[model samples]
Target: MLNFERLQILQKYYDYIQKKTGVRDYFLVGGALRDILLGIKEKLDDVDLTIAGEPIGLYAQMEKEAFSHFITEKFGTITLIPKEGVMQGIKYEITPFREESGYQDVRHPDDIRWTNSLLADAKRRDFRINAMYYRFLNIKKPVYEEKKVLDSTTLLKVLDREGFVFLENSGVLIVQNSSLIDQLLQNGQMDSDFLYYLLDIQHFAYCYGEEGEKTDSDGRFDLQIVIDPEYGIHSLINRKLETVGDPDIRFQEDALRLLRGLRFVNVINQKLLNNENKEQNADPLNKVRLFDFETETWKSIKKNHDLLKTIAKERIYQEIVKSFSEGNPFGLVALVDEAEMLPILFPALAKTKGYDQPIRYHPFDIYAHIILTLWHLQQINSNYLVRFAMLYHDVGKVGQYEQYGLNLTREEIRNILAGPLNHRFSSAELMKEDFRNLGFSNKEIEEIKRYINEHHTPGEILMGNSQNWTKRLRKLFSEVGYEKLQNLLDINIADRLGMYNPLQNSSDLTDSYYLKTLVDEIEQTEGQFKKSDLAITGADVMEHFDLKPGKLIGELLQVGFDWVLGDVKHRNVKKQILANIANYLKQKK
Candidate 1:
């Protein structure tokens, strides 16, 4: 199912190479081919080309013809930059068949050897589905249909003459023999009228791999797609992530493949969800379902989970982010826990696993509550920072209870742990160190720290009956800015919903809505909120106190702002602000 426009561009390049070198030994390989087989409609921009023989002669000729190319001689690969025609802004990395060995560092190969067989090259790849190859052939485009044909009797008669059958119920076409379609196309037995109906059938490609070969003649009748030496198409049709050969050997060769396997599961499940939501009328045979790891693959991943420690923290961080950001995040966490990689990744968060909370506030233990909180954030499409903050917001409770349990009864401890505490500040402190280890930027670390520290402020403001809410909120807005306050409110709502208690609907939900509406109303107004909005400046403080520009000047101004924060009318009166600063200086002296 190659895109018609992309197929034309590929055909042009194929023809150009065939004419230049007088040989046709190249094929399209890797992710581009995989995406085509999966019926993904996104534009296929990056493509890879592989040849069975040497690529130097072709690379030299293309370089001489003024094509921009970069070559890595040792790896036997060349990246060609096509800057003109239909292939503009596309890169084609052409590589000769090669085998790798000796992965001592667990990331790169120590040696590479050239081979002349496509099957040999396929055996050394990561997964079965990515080992296939595709070639563009010279033929007319096959007929394709987006809607069902009403005249099924005439179409079935034509297909029956060609030894094929059309299943009207599922809209799938099946060949009487596995090789019958290939033989007919090769021997020219398929007439134009018959070929039109043959290619136009929906989900016709599902019947392709059973006979040990797969073909895609959609955009090109001579489309010899999927040289699947490892039965990649079968694995794909079964919705399984399988290694090329021995799962253990593959994991031993590259430890990163374990996380990659998990990520593929996440990515495929996301695709399935997207299809269910967006493609209701899609053919059943073509719909992707929930993907899972083959039994052997899952076992190998668990057995080799320790190899992840050898990987760089940055790499592990990237894989974790990719796994959780786009797909079923709860599934990602559960899989990571099942593989026993959670303790190694985040030990502090892992310590909260068995720590139970009071049933009145949380039906689940601390760890499950954290996971549910993360899922709630996911339902609202929160960014990764907020999700990560929620994942560890309550982790400090473990240490908090342990340190204070010496003096309290069991019931008293549970009641104490059921509510928010200074543990949030402790969690923020611990998170800073973890962020430093995981290579988070300084700005990112500070933002997450604020999220953890201020997550409970909105709940306090909304649930409490206080007359100074305007002052507290305006001061909070001044301290962290407006955007961060808004995000903290989101975290508050998610945290409350993650709890399982009677007050969730009455106090929690109503309070959250009230807080949101209050903020929105305040945002719509043009009232002054912070020290910067005051009429008195730092210069006023320095001049009135006979002080130079230093920390004292800023401190005096802050004191002045605090004095007027209780009443908005006092903010614009410079005389009163200076008088307040004078009183603050007298008290300090």
Candidate 2:
């Protein structure tokens, strides 16, 4: 129910709509009903509602009001959002009622049938938990009706026996009957084997498991499936990265969640076991706890987190500015790392282990270094775009390895401790092929491959003359799209950690320096480069020389700039640097 203040705002819009079109009915439903039902024992912050009949303009009226609420139209369905935290600060959304066609495609409906019957409107929805209603009547005066919100008991009644619902909390509601599952199996509403296995009716799995594909979608859950008793969702969502190789199938059913299987186990296990421990205590859920030992699952999740590269540099910049302004950036790096689809979604991350850079400057191999690399990134910068990008920066190392490997000369490795640059393409191709098998979109796989290609040039690290630190910064910005700059430092740090090669008895002397250098850079490199702050302008160089500001002048300026960054002698005098460049150009001529 709206409080006095909300009632006034709601009544004002209600009257405006009624005056415009004599409409008599307006009420709430969907999430509001679910919340109200759930709120009997729990606190709810916002109310959601639906109007039985209303045109598009009603939404405009809601927006015109003084209070803050969201308004949008999704697939011709009008929606309104109210300010969050009125009661306890819950966000509210109001949407119009309309019929949806069956999910003919896995993503969204093909058509919508308009409706006046709100009950009929919600009936064809996917989940029983989502299909609920609450009604209201509009009058000259604010007439509030007191109706019984569906309590936990009432909701439990109509849920089909095979239907399953679990609360975010410990509430469990299941329909014991198999009629719906059986009907779905026959009529092809669902794959019988998945329903059976997923619901733990293991006995019935053989009935539908083998032929499920011929009886179902083009993609079959065939021989590749290796279900270890210990491998499950809890292990998947852990801080450790795990890759769900078949993301298409894992996500196709209920993909939004990282690991729904664990959520099910959480509720189902409570019903299955109560432990007082040795004396009969509630069992701390052995099955749920056991998955941590699943080596394969741990490998997958680790791969997944391993594969998630970074956000673009420009986006990182904005988030940092916002964090500074708001004083609470909300730890976006942790959020990105924690997202379920990240490893698979970002294939570059999925393949992070291909190259094992010798541990010279860091304690960990490339993979382990990336994790600690993230820790170093976080303490220095907090935004998602920056920290995450840093985490993902060397992600291309996977792609760069083969090219780096094939070109390796024993002479160079013994002396410089690095490999050649040609390997990124071959490595990228291998990874791209792998991604194709795993079902990632083509565009992303390509971008990630290119990212690996350009991100870490051995020349930059070793013999090739360097770009001015700022130009190198500009190069990364230009290549990956400037949106992710602030966090790209993560890649450099991770790469630095890759330089670490620990010895059996102690640390390598060279590695200690590399580690110290990387650790030093975390604090040294923050907010280090930008076009807005530079010693010499592009215009200044052009004006000083008899040169136009085209490629030649830019090249000459760049050389001078590098000398300064490399700390070459006489670098403080721009004239001396420019004179050195002019002499080098004359010798070439």
Top model number, lDDT: 1
**Could you tell me the lDDT of residue 450 within candidate 2?**
56
The runs of at least 3 residues in candidate 1 whose Cα sits more than 4 Å from the true structure, single-residue gaps closed, are 1-26, 36-41, 44-49, 52-95, 141-224, 279-288, 408-421, 465-471, 479-482, 503-508, 520-534, 548-550, 560-589
Native RMSD of candidate 2 (Å): 16.4
Give each model a TM-score: 0.74, 0.42
Where does model 2 exceed 4 Å of error? 1-49, 54-74, 79-94, 111-344, 351-382, 387-392, 398-408, 411-486, 492-552, 563-589
Candidate 1 local lDDT, 176-232, one digit each (tens): 332543443332123344445554653432221112212335533344333456655
> Which candidate should be chosen as best, given TM-score against the real structure?
1
Write down the TM-score for model 1.
0.74
User: What does candidate 2's lDDT look like per residue over 1-589, in tens digits?
Assistant: 1011111223233333333323334544333333222221133344554554444655654442423444464554443333322322334445555666544333355666655554445444332333443222211111113223333243333232324321111111122234433432332123435433433432122110011112114332211111111111122223122223344332232222223222222322222222122234434563322112134433333344422233232332343333322222223222334544434444455456434664544444555556556555555555533443344555545545544466757675443333332344444555565455444456655554554454455225432333344444433443443433333434444445444444432222353344334424532543233332335556766776666768977777666665554433335365676576778688879
lDDT of 2: 0.39
